[model samples]
Target: MKSYEEINEKIRAGRAVVVTAEEVIAIAKDIGVKEAARKIDVVTTGTFGIMCSSGAFLNFWHTKPKMKMQRVWLDDVPAYGGIAAVDCYLGATELPSYDPCNSHYPGSFRHGGGHVIEDLIAGKEIKLRAEAYGTDCYPLRSYEQNITLKDVREAFIFSPRNCYQNYNVATNCGAETVYTYMGVLKPHMGNIHYSSAGQLSPLLNDPYYRSIGIGTHIFLGGGEGFVAWPGTQHAPFDPRNERGIPLGGAGTLAVIGDMKQMDARFIRGVSLTGYGVSLMVGIGIPIPILDEDMLYYTTVEDADIQAPLCDYGKEGYPTGEPCVIGSLNYAELKSGEVDFQGKKIRTAPLSSYTKAVEIAETLKQWIVSGRFQLGQPSQLLPGGGSPDRKED
Candidate 1:
């Protein structure tokens, strides 16, 4: 088995050939996996899309008199103040909806915590406020001020979960156009939308924890990040087809990176018509050519990965509640149209393929310029780690 040590040495010697994931696949198809594995040192994968489970930690500088923040708000959007007296986690999905402000405004989510984070990264200022019960040691009860990324000691995006290994194909069987997170679902299954960069996703390429896991280096919103933990709802052992790729949403990752180093382009705040706000972050990871087996997995094409078509008509998308029709490979899914239920259905990607490629190319340049180095995961993901809850 090729070890990471050899790959670093090859890079250091300037003899390594680092190629984008697409190029690696093409090389594999042309020269076969064995030769491609021997000749290539790294294969970088990328995914740029709207990930709901994302947020950043902001250590708002302590105010005069030292207030123990019990409730935090940024540009009127609420933040989780349960962490530390001066620290809070601003979730991207946190809206500005207060008592009378419950989505009554034309665009409630136009400026959310995600927007604040984006503004901070863009070197702009954001208003911050906190409320606290007066304490003897820390007597400041309330405060209001403006802060930027530079004002915070700890400004980083610690996404609890991201890059779902696979996702269910979203479609509408109802008569009305449904606005959900999976983009706008046209009525009567007239259209379908799927997330993930298909073959270009890092975890999808790894499939198993063979390469990707905690401690793995990655490209996060144009900044370097790492896999901090097995993501929330991680299901590493989810049943897969013969190719070992998970069927629906499966294995995930918890990533963290410096918010200051991020770019506004890679950190966008989007407002869905009815669903609410979400962050579209760009992520890229380089897969080291550990061996022939790893190379073979990296060569996996869109045709090999498949997802289940779940009926979105049912509430909560309950397990086995709706019919599980035939599987559709990403090749068919990305065609902008597909045949489903004996009718032609239009398809679209909420994720940006152009951004995905840009991230991939950027990561490739990092490795080639010796600016980025690969890190081995501390451990493998917990297979079938999180399961559904049951009751009597």
Candidate 2:
């Protein structure tokens, strides 16, 4: 069995032939799978989309009286304070202020933890406040200060769930418009919005988790990180096609890495009109050409991928088994139109395709330059045991 260590040595010595997922698709078709897989050493996969489950953990230094923070706020956005002294989890969608929750204020709340996270990553000053009852050994009761990502000893995004395998295309067939986390759906089936980079998504590329096991080294938040666990809501048992690819959402990833090491270009805080705030996260994973089966899967294309067109405007919608309007290939979806209700419905992609390609190219350069060396996962994910932690 060829190991990741061997591949890293090859990459370091400039003997590895790396290609982006899109490029490999054409190469595989032209040269045939056996020859293309024989020549290609690594295939880079990428995705750039809104991940609301994202959040960051900030570990602060001990205060003057050595206070253990019981209440915490960063840039006016509340973070979970019960974890431990000076440690908190700032969720991406958590609003800076509570929603007014009145008829006039419906769905207007915006600024939240995601913005603060982006600012900190940008190396800008951020306000922090915490309150704690005085203790005998750790006496300080409360604290207020302005800090930056540089000021902290530890700062990393510990996203519990990200990079879904596939997603539905949203449409509105009702008389009025509807707002959803999937993006706004215009009334009368006016527009269709979908995400996931079709063949470029990591999980989608290795649909059965054949090569994307827990310890796989990946491009994360603009820096190198590993898949920590099977992300929450993971349904590995979901039905799959003959090729083992799930027709819709399947595997997810729990990833963690230094926020300070990430690039702002691939990390942005976004406000999704009626959907509140979220992080536009960029991620890339390189699938090693371990075998012919892996190679064949990586060659999958947008035309081969499929997702259901679920009506977001319908009342049963999300919770119930959505009445799939229809299934369509990403190539059809990306053509900027979908056939629906006897009319052509325009389409839009919520995920940024340009950034997704940039991530893949960046990872490719790292390998070609011998700068991004791959690591053997200490163990496999979730069941593989916890990963080793280190400070950047």
What are the TM-scores, per candidate, against the unseen true structure? 0.93, 0.93
TM-score of 1: 0.93
Q: In candidate 2, which residue pairs clash?
A: none
Candidate 2: segments with Cα more than 4 A from true spot: 98-106, 318-321, 377-392
Q: What digit string (tens of lDDT, one per residue) describes model 2 on residues 282-359? A: 999998887777788899888888888888886637558556878888899889987766799899999988889999
Report residue 226 deviation for candidate 1 (angstroms): 0.5
The parts of candidate 1 lying over 4 Å away from their true place are 98-108, 314-320, 384-392
Error of 1 at 305 (Å): 1.0
Model 1 steric clash total: 0
- Over 25-83, each residue of candidate 1 has an lDDT whose tens digit, in order, gives 88998999899998888999999999889999988777888889999998889999998
